[model samples]
Target: MDNFLEIETSVKRVFNSFRHEVDGILDRKLTGGEFRVLSLISSGVNRTTDLSKKLDVSASHITAITDSLVANNFITRHRSEVDRRIVVLELTEEAKEFVASIEQKKKEMIVRRFSVFTEEEREQFQELLKKLAEN
Candidate 1:
């Protein structure tokens, strides 16, 4: 029980710290929810239903994020020609470039954070994270 609690606490601390850094990475232009939805669309998860499922959030919550994205001109929503009932989200050219730049900055930050560890240690850390993700 003690070991599990310690692990959980440490995990939460690390996660929170990373999330804080992400806000800086976003430069206050968007919230975490907004960035996540955009990232999902960038990754080909265009449907609102799909995004809600992927993010484990309510449809209304996704709608709120999408609404903000639309208002900010980061995304445009349209119905699929084959399936008018379904809405598709697309990143504007401006958003595409923004996402790309943010992604690069995030990658650099992660690399710098992990650079202190030896190569073997980093590989082991990655394997551990992958195992947790898979389960």
Candidate 2:
């Protein structure tokens, strides 16, 4: 129990640190939730229902995030061709470029953060994270 609690605290601290770094890198252009939604959309998770399920968020929450993305020209929605009742989300060309840039910046940041670790240590750490995620 104590070990689990320690792990949880460490995870929270790491997540908070990463969020702060990314937020600064993004210049506050989007919230973490918004960025996550956009990233998922870019990865082909389009429908609001799908996003809600994937993110474990409410449908209305996804709607609000999509609304902001639409307003910023980051993404656009259209009715699905096969099902008019279903709306699909897509990233605009500009948004694609923006996301790519953001991804590059994030990669750079991660590389910098992990620079102190040896290659084997980093690989082991990644494996451990994957194992935890699988659980």
Best by TM-score: 1
Q: Per-residue lDDT of 64-98 in model 2, one digit per residue for the tens?
A: 99999999999999999999999999999998998
Instruction: Write the residue-wise lDDT of candidate 1 on 25-122 in tens digits.
Output: 99999999899999999999999999999999999999999999999999999999998999999999999999999999999989988999999999
lDDT against the true structure, each candidate: 0.95, 0.95
* Alpha-carbon TM-score of each model against the true structure: 0.93, 0.91
TM-score of 2: 0.91
- Runs with alpha carbons beyond 4 Å of true place in candidate 1: none
In model 1, how many backbone clashes occur?
0
